[model samples]
Target chain A: MARPARRGGGYWVYLIPSLVLFLVVIVVPFAMNVTTSFTRWSGVGTPTWVGLGNYAKLLRDERFWASFQHNVGLIVAMAVVPTIIGLVLAAALFDYIGRRFGTRTASALRAAYYLPQVLPVAVAGVVWGWMLHPSYGAVNQIFGLKVNWLGDSDIALATVMAVMVWFQLGYPVVIFMAGLQRADPALHEAAEIDGASWWRRFWHITIPQIRPEIFVVLLTCTIAALKVFGPIFVLTRGGPGSATMVPSYFSYLNFFQKADVGYGSAIATVLALIIVVVTFLFLRLQERDS
Target chain B: MRTLRAPGGPPGRWAVLAALVVLAVVMLFPFVIVTLNAIKSPAEYSSGGPLSLPQGVYLDGIVEFWQRVDFGRKLWNSFLISGTVALAAVVLSVLNAYAIGIGRVRGRLWILVFFLVANTLPQEALVYPLYYLAKQAGLYDSTLAVIVIFTVIQAAFGTYLLSAVLGQFPREILEAAALDGAGRWRTLWRIVVPISRPTLSVLVIFFFIWTWNEFFLPLIFLISNDNQTVPVALGVLQGDKMMDATMSSASALLGIVPAVAFFLIFQRTLTRGITVGAVK
Candidate 1:
């Protein structure tokens, strides 16, 4: 029932405008950044070739290292906590709400859960910063706790991580809920017939079914945690003496504020390399594991 | 078998529902606070917890806040930036995705993968470099320059998503159109566009919301008040009037109003975007 081959060159005509625009805007700029990273340019004058000087400086730079460490901390915290909490929340919701409510309510609830996602990160960061304000803010006032969220190095990173989690939880929860909805109900029914406990059924049936969702959630989240910026900017400005500085924030400060455009470009180039390599390795590892 | 009266079920369900309601309320409390506080007098805001409801709904605070922040002009700027960016991005992405999705281009998979890799790069890393290039081109502090970058950076991911959608679409439809002497442009304009409206609309909403709320881009690119978007404008307002809850809240409200309107308009599609086969 295969149709005969047809001849047409219309695709090329339609493709030209988009290709030119993307190449000039994205591809060219990206290549330029890579090239600029090896030079000593201060954003106003001619760029001088420095032959890996910027990369070497980045290697020994304590501030850059501090930012990397902060990102590592955030990635670990965000990756593990949100995935687990989101999964648990989905499980409880599916077990309880899925069986009782009609399809419309379930979807409405899902939308409610995802409201945070529509929020601009800047607004979320600002609102959260205000909420965690030390004196008359709701978080402090509600719990009668007087801790400064963005101050005091000990708690600054954690506070940022908490806000990140709050802002991020909705996406993963909805993802997990969708995964749960797609899982085979018969497996649960069989477990029910066998008189398995709710916890037991979840462990045996639900967890294994949604492994792919779990993996995707973890990967996307780890990458997002590494790239986090708006909250850091709005809340702490990578402050309390670099307590909350992440690689993105550090790179931004260096390139723009510090006027070390070459070094900043180099840091950014390295970050891009890290993301590509890490994601490649992760996909490879997942393929092998499966 | 368990029923509503089962030993550990009915009451437990109620408890869970109650907890969820509480969570929802807590989640929404900030909006309530920002709304009420923005409507209160400056003196009232300074005197009590920001979470406290005002004694009366006062327009004076909102009026003063609006004037101080230049809310109307900032909102118009934000609308212009975000609207243009989303529109241009959708056009570019739809075209790019169409090329790769339906065209006989070689290395299509590689192109898609390159876009994916580019999309994952930390945005902060590119901020300074882009700024440098813009300044070099004498486009600094210009609205068009920011819109160009926003549209471009966003187009990479937009292409990635739209291409994924296009790939899932059956090519037979396009092939059949071609068999009937319909050209690629005609086929895409007549056939592909109609089928892909759902995905395209979702993309539009996503881009609009993100572009509207974006701060880092505007912060670096827009150094002039005339170029500032709502979010950047609000940040400046906060800096200018430190600790003025009414002013800050009013700005926040203004920043969010457009987003809320967009969300309400496309609520169903937006929800579906987050859930429907999203993990893939």
Candidate 2:
């Protein structure tokens, strides 16, 4: 069932353009960034090598630690919470709604959920920022409360998290719903005939059926949470006094705002390392499971 | 398939439907509020609060925002950049996938993995260096720089997906093409590409949307007012203390229009593409 083997050396020509572009855009710039992390530079003068100095400083930097801590919160908001809720919503839409209400209702609901995902994150930030504004904001106007959504340091991160949940909820719903389409209806019908509850069937059949998608969703969303910047930039700017700062925005501030390019590079390098490790761990777990 | 309802059908099912409707409304609440507010004058908003219906349609805020941001120019920049990146990245992906998938070039697995990792590398890791280099190359604040950068980044994902799809290409077709004396380039254009058009179209659409939504790189590189993309322009304006609530809502509405249009137009393809990309 195999095709004839082709001569391979000449094929390298096809790869040359892509390879060159990769080197220029990703490889070279990434290498330079890592190298820059080892030096003290203000984006102007020659870089002075100061091996591990930026990393050591990061260990003692309260802001750096706080930013990573916020990333943990974001992980919960963007990945963990969304996956749980998405699983249930997807099952309901696929199994319950599609059966009773029809596929039209199910898809319409899915599209409504997916609306935020299509919008640029910055635009989403604007929408939420306006809605949550303390004075003239819609939430306050509707609920008749004076709670400051983005101003108070205490409530700000939670507000941001809630907005992120809104922004991220759609992704897992869409993916899990798609994965559920591949599940055999007979399995569910057989379970139902035996008096297995909806909850039971969902646990036994649905979860296991969509495990690959669950892994994919969690991995991608977690990575997105870690690298989240646009929302922070537009909504909170990592403050009312550094309350909602995340690593990506923190690094950006260092690079552009504060002119500490070396430290920024170090922060970015660490973030890149963490993301790679997380991805590998997920792949390894997926491999072990299958 | 037999239709099976819950034991308590009407009450339980209706309750579930009601809850889902509520959730969907909650998800859409912001857009609803923004749209309501965007059409109200400041006087009307302050008097009626955000919950009140607008007395009359007000286009002044949206008009003001458009003029202030030169939004037409921003839209053109976004369209041009995303359009170019989509076309260029698809071409790059096809070429690379050809070598690795159909050609089965040496070390293809390693090359695929390299692309996978490259795709995962955060923009932060490449941003500053790219910034400096762009500056050095006298391409600072140029749309060309952004177009080039995203072309490579998006192609990484495209190449990864396309390689797998092309690898499973029924070798009988390639063998047949060869039997007829079709060269590599000839076979690729006349046979391989046409067969793979569906996947390539998916790649083009995904690349365009992804590039359209990109914030970090464009935010850094496209610094000038005239060069900024839609998201960046709207974002930068968000920090301005002078922007009134009506104006901001107007801005948000403007930003959302094109994205929602794209989503509605390409909803089917986007969903199918997402599933294929993720599961594969």
Candidate 3:
């Protein structure tokens, strides 16, 4: 049944200010970035049209492909790996720890896990940099080892991925905890009464019950992984060689550092398109599932 | 509460508790280590173990970090930018949320969908064009440029949140106000804002923390040394060949202290904001 409508035709006026700024700052520039991607231009002078040239270069560019490879690695490292780890941690907190102790303790523990999410990436980078320093860093000396954490090309990306995983762990934990709240207790009880072990019940009942939250975590964290720039900017500056360069960093380097605005915009547009497409696909999948 | 049984009574429960404690320690230990090293001299840092206490209350790391990083200026700039964005963003969101939510404006559903998409456009996507625009406007190096960009970003989220809050406002109250000849703006300023204080506080707190921590836009826009926010300013401390592990440790501590303290203080509200925003 439809509710009675409020009396107003001028209500659109209230939305004007937010809409204007949003369009100018976000929508219009987004359109400009799309057009700029097609042209050849440095940051200065005037733009010259060279349709498809940048995209052609982008496709053939080894660094571009390598950056995508790193992004895929990041997907596994930051999004996929963390989701699995966070789920188990969250399940333990919800099913075992919190159930045994109390929610107060469980939520407190949740906050502790959430510490990394609160700090800015720059700050987290500094802390990690201090810890991962090659010579006198705490992590190396503590283990009585020497490793170039942010330098050596072979392992710097892996190191950065590890940090992103750490930063992302808490978000899913909290979201999953809350998702668990809405789960039906009956299913868990039924599984338990059938003499299932804790693992069995969690596998059959808990994961299935909170499937939507898993998707939520996956989609959000994956987008975050794609846009990861801050920590890289601080910790490694895309590193000793181009080891940790993701598309986001690649774009910034091309734009500000390399002064190839067209190429930079192309990289950014490609990355942004990927994020939007993946997000759209996930949302559609979610809609279909429900 | 007992729908799901604990597998075993005490032993199993204790193991789970121990595991959780370990997880918490793993999460929090980095902060503790950083704090311990912040006050140590570079010599103490190198010679002693990572966990060793400073021999003498040496504070050179923090002192050097303070003098070198333009610490006070960064804090002030962060404060000003975050405050301005929070205030302005909240007002814009409140007004927009009011029209679409309480006023039940036509095409309200479309407006909400528009913002949902707008919110996801990786803000980095716009940094270039914004850079170009700011340069043209002579706002390239100004804090105003950062403020203007961030306000729009935060305002998008704020609209969604405050809209939900406004939608819950009792109709009878608004009807009474309308009957009293109060106009829309008047009813809003007089009634809706006061009653929606809790949600507005949530929006403001979230915006304040987000803007203060915002790095990319400010990093690109605010190029001047003194104009950068806390995160971007502190970012320069890392990877400097001359800068030691001690200064990095100290800067890390300084960078996190404010956000962490704010979190602890308003944790109840902040936690609510997270869960609400998530489950929505």
Candidate 4:
């Protein structure tokens, strides 16, 4: 550690390349998003300054609100339901599987559960799209009924959410398993000695201990849900009267399909702010805990 | 086997096992369905229903799907793009992570904060401007666009992973390398890298899977068919006339093989990478 000055120089020097790339690819574009959202750019010619016109339009855009509602629906499907199920599954595995089978079985079970996460989003999208194809799709055949899984506007968002839940379920299960592993064994044994039932012990001991993991799962899943595109992009394509539309894909459509770059940028910028704000909120909670 | 404790405990364990098995089946449902459907002829898929066994194993759907998409080129394109980006990301991450993570530099914490925020920013926010930029630079519709975009994004994530690797380095080895009169570059290349190879492989795999799965950037930038990547090509095929249920199942199956195989092969390390990255 002789020449601390030169060492510092090397450190700062190494950050430059990645930083430059970050600034160019991320920072500059983000700044442009802020500016472009204020202008009417059709992505072909010069952008005209519009000054919050797009933002004003977005405030009243039914499709925008509908997509945002779908995002909320996605949150329920992708985050809340999966986290609940994942928690129960993880608890069951942690509390029971360890004693009954072994760590090997538990681990194998986790790997199996995480199988869907291994596949690319596009692959999942395509596979589910086929299975959910309203007419002759397998899902309907298997259910022994004619159900429009992806065609009915009323249920299309729900169907997409179901797929999102499936795609996202594995992530939380994995995280929760790890979190549950860190819980003190003696604490559980002590609770058991007090005649605590499985459900009660889990609620009192497991949930409180793994709150951080739950928060992490929730934040990640919520963000992922809010930003979901690939499955919707490939599955429904915002179909059945924009039923399954999400902010990310909606923004994509606005930019490319509608050729309304200014409005698209506005939608994206708002979504970006939501993510950042939520992230910061989570960070604050995490920091305060620490 | 002799009677003994199983895993988590004795009570309610069978129930947990049953539940896990159910969840596992749900998770593998798509894979099973795809595998069964992909080998079947389209007529069988429509007529025979979901649980119907293939009358004969007609592998021609996959064969035809392969040729129709000219998937060989797209496959090469995927490998080229993913390999190039993963390698670049790993290299850049090693250097950048060494600086902030191992160098004990001032503001290293702040630098990591910047990275955290950067990584959190969604691609939707950046793609529009990137589209405009790529067009002006004459890089639009080129594989270079996809490669560069993925490299930059993956490097941000890779930096976080590799930084953890550097953080876990044994100080003694680093000091020994320095005392042996090895320059920083030599120490990093020969000593630090050798020690961090496992973690580096984790980062590489992470980038490879992430880059291969990337869709939006290529969709926006690579407008032409020949330049499109696997996921983008697959995305286009989702809407194309030639694509059908059986054919797309074939495409989906083939597209996921490399990634899913990699996951199975490196499940331990990749799982550790994720849990360590997110939870820790």
Best by DockQ: 2
Number of the top-ranking candidate, with TM-score as the measure: 2
Cα error, candidate 1, residue B264 (Å): 2.9
The runs of at least 3 residues in candidate 3 whose Cα sits more than 4 Å from the true structure, single-residue gaps closed, are A1-8, B1-10
Off by over 4 Å in 4: A1-7, B1-16, B239-241
Task: Indicate the residue-level lDDT of B78 in model 3.
Answer: 95
TM-scores, in order shown?
Answer: 0.91, 0.98, 0.94, 0.94
lDDT of 2 by residue, B1-280 (tens): 3344445466778999999999999999898889999999999998998878999899999999999999999999999999999999999999999999989999999999999999999999999999999999999999999999999999999999999999999989988888888888899999999999999998899999999999989999998999999999998888467888898889999989999999889988899998998899
lDDT of 1 by residue, B1-280 (tens): 3354365556677777777667666656777776777788877866766766788887876677678666788788888988899989998888888877767466778878877776777666567656767878999898898898788777888888887788787977877786888766677789998989988877777788778888877888888877788777665444233555566666566655666677788877765776643554
Kindly report the interface RMSD of candidate 1, rounded to 1 decimal: 3.8
Q: Mind giving the per-residue lDDT tens digits that candidate 3 earns over B1-280?
A: 5624444575757777887899799889889888888878878877787889877766777877888877889999999999999999999999989997898887887888777777778876798898889888898999998888889888887887678777878999988887887777788899999999888888888899889888888888887887988998888657678777887788889998988988899888987888777666
* Residue A249 lDDT in candidate 1: 78
The candidate that wins on lDDT is: 2
C-alpha displacement of A19 in model 3, angstroms? 2.6
Better of 1 and 2 by DockQ: 2
Q: How high is the lDDT of residue A144 in model 4? A: 84
Error of 2 at B51 (Å): 1.7
